[model samples]
Target chain A: MATGNSEVVNNAKALSIEVDKMSKLRVIHYINQFYAGIGGEEKADIKPEIREGFVGPGMALNTAFKDEAEIVATVICGDSYFNENIDEVKAEIIEMIKPYNADIFVAGPAFNAGRYGVACGAMCKEVQEVLDMPAVTAMYEENPGADMYKKFVYTVATGNSAATMRKAVPALSQLVLKLAKNEVIGTPEEDGYLARGIRKNIFEEKIGAERAVEMLVKKLKGEAFVTEYPMPAFDKVVPGKAIKDLSKARIALVTSGGVVPKGNPDRIASSSAQNYGRYDISTVHDLTSETYETAHGGYDPVYCNADSDRVLPVDILREKEKAGEIGELYKYFYTTTGNGTSVKNSLAFAREFTKELIADGVDAVILTST
Target chain B: MVKGIEESGIPVVHICTVVPISLTVGANRIVPAIAIPHPLGDPNLSKAEEYKVRKRIVDKALHALTVEVTEQTVFEN
Candidate 1:
């Protein structure tokens, strides 16, 4: 529940999209605390709130809903608060949503503000995954969360500011009804959302390599063909100063080779991995077939499964640790399968676990790939 | 993973069989290895020989961590 002391922001502007008839289907909307009439950055640490009925931009959304559905509840969280304390906030929001039993969830047309966009994306993705319900969010095509969640959720494309709310409402409302009614979802062009880059498997006239070259030709000519993976602008990394002493530095092993304790208890994918696993190796001196195996599918797993040390070199590093050639090996190793995994997911996994590495005082890392 | 860890100011050496792929993905320090399936081990050899091969590759990766490279550079093994 938003406090009465909250001050309304830019959401009071008139939007043209409207409908007179009340709808039956219930919808839950998500917006940042600022849009809930909470103050700006200075007050961005406010926690989650469930306000009964529409607030701010949810008004325009309600107009769009018209005869199909109505905004039953609005969930608001500060952008910073949502991003900084995601795990806790996510669980809290899920609990808040359970009582409403809303048919569909809609997050912000977040525009170009990065944190809000990511929050909207994260909320929509979580709703779909954990609640097993349809969810949608709108944001600028270039929003950081666009590439990260576009494949996992439906995201309507919007302009770079709240001014586009009018145009955004109809498309978002339309998607809400479509999802609520269990209607067929269309291509991005037809539905007014960003492309998900999900390729359908259909027998083509040409082989893949030949078709790839053909796509290259079409791309050069600016002809019509579905676009392929676009490389994101990679961060320019400043090289860390060389480790000054081998005997004293804490060395850690991280891998994209996907070596795990036998049976891979986490069920991490053998290819196109969606998650990473951290395993404790405090007592592990040698990797054996009975104790470890490879989950990577892009290469022969036999060698790695026979001796997981092949991919991780744990046996050698263990020896190095004992001989005082290097400092102690970090107790946990992070691993994932690199096969067909998206760069966006890879970047996310790294961003998450690297924090743990730094917090644990690991001085250096050795990353291996198959 | 290599570049991400490095960006956080922890030096990382990427050990992989494909040096070119490592270069393309922006690992500052790289170490070449044996093959895709067995980056540091050779099943064709005896246990002692295979261990020596693994140790050599691991030693090079550790060495790569201590070398200051101005750009993406691979330390061959």
Candidate 2:
């Protein structure tokens, strides 16, 4: 074991890895059996739980993520997400993450430990796929999950054991920040994101059409040309179900996909929002500066914050409500930030929100997605 | 949201311009609009066109509320 040196916190030594300091990013972290401060082997069968702030290498991760973002939430689960009751665990953990506002997600600094690596790889892939978000996890090059899910997510190769935790976090953090900025990342060799067994364009100097044409011409002539764009293919979410009826059902409008007051007075973060509050607009025609405000951070606040009713369509729905075209429109509208939102968290919110609507006898929903 | 509401045992009439998402999330009834960002009306268009689009889609969504369907159905606008 890499002993003696482990006792002291070496934040400076940990962050000494060179990186593009210009990029600013926000990040969410995921952890496993030991690092969650959970006892390993003894606690290998641990279920998922939510925690705020840093745990284990999370301190190093925070420093690594400095100027980039705060590590908003640290989700901890065991290797058992696959070995034990996988489905329930995934669902439960996903539900746990719905409320936070985040720009990027990171899982494991899973060193060389095989099971831990697999766990990290799987979790990162699941997050990236289901949430339509960016995710990264680190594992030893030899971990089996590395082979399985590395192609799907950003899985970095690492040395064996916790001794490498310092090295792992910075490598993963750099890639994660680049992801948040929507900047092009190279293959595993260049950017440290697990190689997807495919190469993509990562332009060094120029961008857009002119560069694209130059690269294309080089490729056509069988000459070497570094591409300017390397976009990862996203898995399409299977569409939402079709509604049965419209005119007769009492339809209500709901948006937590961040419909807010124009000024964003509540100052909600786009990806990892912690606060969720419903504004009272019972007496107002449309949400105004004094009447209602936004806590959502998914978009440019000016438009939605100035007129939240536009995003929620409260006025329009109210107009429908007055006509008695169908039935009563629920007065309270739910709100939350959708940027960098995780599937686990969103579903949990959905289940809770469903209960509220049910009790109120709300018949239907007309949700707008940004 | 409509699909989520319906999953909780209430009926819903999902209004979306994105036909694919509406169909898959299991919304019981759906009404197609012009585009994604503005499902009812295009903000850039003339008021007449906006109203024309909104009136047509909104009418379909409202009408869908009255009808019963065994499976997912889209209201043609």
Candidate 3:
């Protein structure tokens, strides 16, 4: 898996295999057993198979590619087998795929079928990350795999079922052609794909304030306008059960309020923190102004710098520990700056520390944010 | 971070000045704090008074951690 200088997936990769501009690009298509003309659920356990040309939906994609590209091979795997033994199947599939020296990889417009969509997403992710080549897939936005794999694959948004196969192929093929030809792809709207939550800076004709004024003018006149930045989707989780007994439960303190040692030892960003700090608080009973301070840059830091407990609440929690109101305070506290931090990075930080908390038998977490 | 820990099956109470954002982000247990700069502190009061105030808010947060909640809930006292 070698990456070229271009880090942007939409940007043309540094071509390793010679591309004779006029030659028909070789394409590899992935499909499930059902699409390979195999029996339905009974044959869902069928092993991975490679064939000479296009399969079911591939027929439509092949037509869309027309003379510009052709499906040189079709790789088919049963949904059950692929998912159950994902790693084994992925390696096997890549070995099957490598011989084709294919220009691009394309997987299902799996629609709403959960397992199939996951397989397609998983395969596309593997192809992109392992082969270091562009891969495309299509699925409904609500499909489980779409959320899991959309960031890794340039997923073409499609309707909920195969009934929309007619509309999905052209879009998928267009993106596949662009990747295969190493052409620059455009925005999700201009190109027919789902928003991958990737940001690309571009120069515009108008200045920021001018555009904002124009958009405000349109809004006042009841005209439609698109927002430059869209909020990331938030997932609602089923809350874990509350502690049965506070005195018996070990508690941990974590914060986006960014309380670190006095000198900012870890060098965490005062805003938009790319990393978090886990400081040992077991030896320290209280967060004194001389020992600890706030690193967050969003609000006035004077208060937090004076008493870091205002944000982390370490002192009161220590008092509670002495009173046996709580079993004990965790020795370490996790912290990061909340200001200007993306939801993606925040989620990543939490997921990483929760594993350690779980291992340490922490029963509950108190999170403070400014 | 609150959502992450909670989703991983550890009960978590979020202490933030922005209760609406906590609710919108699906935090199961929420505790409204004093202000943006100091979530648990009120600098206007004397040191002893501020400590008591911080203690009260923190006590509420601990209680919120112990209470059973079926959906997003704000704990304010």
* Best of the candidates, lDDT: 3
Candidate 1, backbone clash total: 0
Candidate 3 local lDDT, A1-370, one digit each (tens): 2355345442543342235333888889999988888866456668999999898989999999988899989999987567657789999999999988888899998875555777898898898888887889998876657777888899899987688999888889999999899999999988888888999999999999999999999999999998887787557888889888999989999999889999999999986679999999997888989999988863668889999989999999999999999999998999999755656788899999999999999999999987
Winner of 1 and 2 under TM-score: 1
The candidates, ranked best first by TM-score, are 3, 1, 2
Question: TM per model?
Answer: 0.50, 0.42, 0.51
Q: Please give the ranking of all candidate structures by lDDT, highest first, separated by commas.
A: 3, 1, 2
Error of 1 at B50 (Å): 0.4
Model 1 lDDT per residue over A264-296, tens place? 989899766899999999999999999999887
* Model 1 ranges off by over 4 Å: A1-234
Model 3 misses residue B74 by how many Å? Answer: 27
| lDDT score of residue A202 within candidate 1 | 58
- Candidate 2 stretches with Cα past 4 Å from truth are A1-250, A261-267, A288-309, B1-4, B16-28, B33-37, B46-52, B67-73
Candidate 2 lDDT over A1-370, as tens digits, reads 3555663445445555334332335466888767877775446557888788767777887887766676777888765343345557666766777677567778887764444665666666666777777888887664555666777887877765677777777787788778888897775788765677665555456657777888789999999987444575442223333344433454556665565555555675665555444555566565554555445432334434444543556666666767765465676666667444443465566667778777866666666543
The digit string of per-residue lDDT tens for model 2 on B1-77 reads 34445656655666654454455445567776554334454667675665565656656766666666777788785
Query: How many Å off is the CA of A311 in candidate 1?
Result: 0.6
